[model samples]
Target chain A: MIKIYILSIFLFTGFFVNSQNLKPEIKYLQIINNQNNKFIINDNIRNAEICADSLFYRIDTYNNDVSSFFLLLSESYYLLKKYDLALFTLLQQRILFYSDSINIYSKKLLNQCLNKTNKKLPASFSILEKSLDTILFVNSAQKVDFLFSITFFINSKNTKHKLLNLITFYEKYFNQNVSFGMAKWKLLNTAGINLKTQTKYLLINDFNNPLSDYDNQDLLYNLPIKLKNKILNHNT
Target chain B: MFFIGLLLFFASEMFSQDVDFYIKNQNDNFDFQKMPKEMSFDEYNILSQSFRMQDMMFGFFVPGYVHFKANDKKTGYALVTLSSLSYATFAYQLVWSKNNLSDSSFFYNLNNLSSLSSDLKTNTLIMGGALFTIGSSYLFDIIHGKYRLQKKQNAIRYKYSLKASLSDAYIPNKYSNIACFFSMKIYF
Candidate 1:
């Protein structure tokens, strides 16, 4: 009778323990916190190594049931400075969902963005944009759009299209009064050298030079004559 | 279910061969072994989070390879057997589809010509074969999502079945059990 009762207790506690084990959501939150605090956490290579090993251990124990694992893995790899692995791992997971099931919305979108940034894979901008166009797909689309815009802004080749995509995405799905306008300005400034429009290029170039108030100071700063000429033309 | 599992396992194993071949034939170069284990700390953090999300949260999570005890010896085997099975099943379908292509042109020309063109018949068979292979593999991937769950269950079982070790090392909370501890033997 005692053995039977003890066994029941054991079973109940076993269930309880597992029920409280590191949940996928909790794990993901921890990883995000780590990323935010990486400057502190990364002060020691030993600490970084410890965290990396811990993450790998957790990943190895993960069951393929969680939808977020692939995302978490991608993030973890990114943190480890393993850009190729992070991108490749995400691609592998995306292929699994794409070639297998319909529940591949986020993975496919993220894959598209990463592929574009890496320039290792083909860009499916239309497919990503089309999916993000839906209201019901808002949550997934927003998360994916954020990644897309960040990747696009960083990429040197498709600055115009990337900015346009971000602009369109924000204008259509997000509030116009938001900080996305700041992102637009940054993009324009970054890609300003290639701008064909004289006014637009000057606006960016003036912001970069910032020498209208003092001429001798600008000369001492060795500001380029062509840039000074462009600035003068814009001011006049 | 066991037979189905077995069937799926072999099928996926077969399919992986075709996928491997196709991926190889595409001339897209990648050396998986040469790739870095970890990148930026942020990237590592994300990959870890993604893995946990994929494996532990929504689905039965399984690592690719895990240690299992068989006859008192630690043996590492693939935790996700279904992945291998799906590959095998896909392979079988690919091979089967390749062999069953109908010579439509030969039939179309039967009423007009006395002989069928050998090259046309051969090409049709080859093209059909390739499509069948690709189509079957694609289908196998779709069908094997559930099998992936089963593989995760097997991994948990394998973890539980390991023999108890002697040392009672207190592992760190931040680190995973897998890499938290190591044993050192000292002779004084």
Candidate 2:
């Protein structure tokens, strides 16, 4: 009975076309952390306004990653329905100067803000899912940084060269940043810490414990070789 | 990627030697002798069943269902948590709604409803985010699961091939190019 009335209403009131194809209009961008968790960001104007004020207070506020302040400030603008301000804030980091910056959340928010304001997409606005657009032009200094990064991934000898090979592969196959991260230098420090923790575990555990427990990539398979080396080199 | 890989993948990607050969020699890696074991259709039902796009598509709706099927529990749980938090935002928005406007009638109260409330201007930001988490999670699962499945396939192939070397039952007799077990002809 209720279904029939609903159908009749739809038929009479020009509700023939389904309007599902439109792009999403969620006003604010998500605050996705490294763990893939979205922290419940308070959209309170006072907090957001304070955040913007605090950004100016420190050349290195918000955990010393100054880039994050832009995201917070832009996100504040988005929550406050200040779409133009959001677009303007995010664009500066994305295209104007920090092109080398790996802060993708800002780029993502830029796209959202662009849509909110019904503006044309900017050149800096690439789909944020995973475009490591600038990796192909890596300079010598960045290439060296891969050695420290590579140690976090592989447990093999000649890790430095292997990282280079992977970087080339990333350019050839992925054409993106090594990690799908938004903040700068976080991936390196995190990977380095994980590797350090695992290395210490392997040294103390008499090569019996596994490195996979430490979240080191594929190190479980390589542990046997290291174990054998430790055994062979052990002095009585 | 339309967006990714992590550290352990270096073994799959760059372990073979120089960059030049890695690209040139991808074919060499495909050699049957070195090929990962022929995974039984049932063994990797996920890959074998991917021809059914419906199943893969449905997996996306459940948010991490594909990853759970892929046996990547760590990632699967993360996605589940992400989806839950994403949806929970809606509940949060409802309790603390800035506007009196609620879309409860968007589905149930359609007779009185004339337009879609789930648009860019809808006061609820959570509605837009609902699809984003699930969609991204499913896509990530597909990429991560592909590598994980391949790695498992390679591991099993190496294990069985090593066992076959001593067993002689699966060995290729030099007189015949075809291997008894794999039934593949050696080129060189």
Candidate 3:
């Protein structure tokens, strides 16, 4: 009878400990859900921050998938214009999630923060170069978004060579996907705008500038109009 | 049946795992890598505000004014041309008539110098008024066009600046030192 009593006691303690461990995880999850709903549904950053802070408090620092939580926190900070803290959080995300995809996103976020701080772009393009192949192969909307971002950054910095390379990549992408659609229209519009901006830049820098190697005046003028017509027709 | 349903509802609430289940499901589908790395809301807001200001300054009324002024220029030019031509013709007629009245034998015999001078003065006054009106209108148009162009150029030339400062002030023997201060200023 004593042995059986001791066995029951051990079983009770084990279950209690298991429940205790499960409670925090469950609480953390509930807090995360509340945070996501607040942020995504209500668009309430303040409430989301409260829930995120609650989750952070409960989360075990030693062992947990902290990347998602860190991403949430950083995004909130970013929206709040606390960029230094956002940058620090992203660095932590990099350390935790050392995947190539995360690295690309982290670098992109870092670049944005740097841009906002009026800092020069990092001289090394190694991260972007390494991720280019993988990004190209990914059949997702992100492919266009990533290309657009790089193009926008290059245009702002007036980096001609990198811009040309991105343009070439876009041409290749268009050729690979021949079906005319909204995505294609968006890409065409972006390219046209970038081309027009580049021409303006050239005009400002060199009044007596010779003809540009990439300048197909006909394409430059017609492509944007064609894209607009396509969009209008699609919408109608 | 209602009583049973209420009891079941309370029981389900007591054992609810909906939040946990939803979070787990979301985790399964969430791809952080695919998330867009866009600019901060504050930066985007500032950019959009500046764009709105630019549109307000240069896009709406300014463009309308420029187009209206351009059309006005064409009409004003035509009016000036016609008025100048008419004035020149009248002046020439007055000059020729005056010379004839001074030299011709018929006018000398008629001795109508007062009438001839009166007609010449009337013609000169009309010519002078036409010249003044056309000249002033043309000058006004020129000045207005110049002002519009200058306003447009100023609107287009947007500038932005960021400044940061740190300072500490001390008045030794007179007062306590001021604490170190830091500030950042952005101008657009």
Candidate 4:
């Protein structure tokens, strides 16, 4: 009994000391997450509005985890059915995090927005996509798989007639674009094997690695016999 | 229900392969393995909060860890079994799906194409359903553990929140548990 009492006192004091020393940023993140739970999962719009406001104020665009804030904000908007606002928020995220074209989460949210909308994508989206596509070929992000956000966007249920034409154009454009390794891994994967080779589009290679990159345009289009042999063989 | 949803969200967050991959691809400065070299007391104090959050997150990552934490051994063991079975089922299905795909060939023929799409849809739906079950068990474990801990905390807090004025002192044998007894009571 006495030991239990001592242990309890130790824990109490530790908690008190810990609470007194928490970082304001960290504390605010906790508060925001709790409020997000109330709204995002619990479906409390009032709390969602409050959460969006709190998140909006605290977002440090320079912070690495700032995407989480942007995502949460967009999600709050999504629940509120303000999809255009959601897409606009994600557009800002896309432009700011220019190097993160491979981020599937943002793309998925964008897909949800596009599927739910009746209108054509704003001109800004076109302008942004043009610039981002340039980044994709020039300074290719290393961590990206073959699946880009546009893949997700393409798969979204087309609500606009203009969007259908755009998807068809994109389909022809990206047909030959996935990394060799990602394409092979798809064959090994359950869903990948089921879908025809043409349907698989994701960013799956590190540009830094020659083996993964397949820098030669022709080699990128067709996986070379030697590349196949090296992968299939246990020893390189 | 609210707590269940919260636990499920964290459970998925803790277990998501995509998030794991994303974290690996992100900058290395956030890695917890290496300690920061030579920090002031301020940084150290702030760092301690991360460790505390990590302590909470540990409960999220490990199946039944929270239940064990709350001292419900029976429930904890049950959760462990359930989650293990859930993982096993998911793995088995994945393996089956791969093998099933390998055994089949896609053809441009209309009949074959329709069957292939249907098979793909069914396989994916099965995987999604199994994942939902796995997530639920993890959710249950966390909620039960937290609820038990909260119950204990409320009991302790209630005792501590009571306040009383010191009064009728050591009246012999009046109060056996203490040195003195209070006549006037205050409740908060």
Report the alpha-carbon TM-score of model 1 versus the true structure. Answer: 0.22
Query: Candidate 3 lDDT, tens digit per residue, B15-56?
Result: 554313224435533533221122244323333221112222
lDDT tens digits, residues A151-204, model 2?
323333223332444344444444444432111123223234343545443332
TM-score of chain A of each: 0.30, 0.28, 0.29, 0.33
Q: How would you encode candidate 4's per-residue C-alpha lDDT over B134-183 as one tens digit per residue?
A: 78877786676777555544432321121111111213342244323224
Clashing pairs in 3: none
Best by lDDT: 4
Off by over 4 Å in 1: A1-5, A18-21, A24-67, A79-81, A91-105, A116-236, B1-188
Sort the predicted structures by lDDT, highest score first: 4, 2, 3, 1
Q: Write the per-residue lDDT of candidate 3 for residues A1-236, one digit (tens) a residue.
A: 99999899879867554334323333333343455533232233333334333433332232233455555556555665656555545544443223454455567776776666564422223464455444335543334333333333333333333334434544554444222222332334454445553434332112122233332332234345665455345444
DockQ of 1: 0.01
Per-candidate Cα lDDT values, in order, are 0.39, 0.44, 0.41, 0.46
Q: Which candidate is the best by TM-score?
A: 2
Candidate 4 segments exceeding 4 Å error? A1-236, B1-52, B102-121, B156-188
The residue ranges of model 3 lying beyond 4 angstroms of the native Cα positions read: A1-64, A96-101, A120-236, B1-188
**Lowest lDDT block of 10, candidate 1 chain A:** A53-62
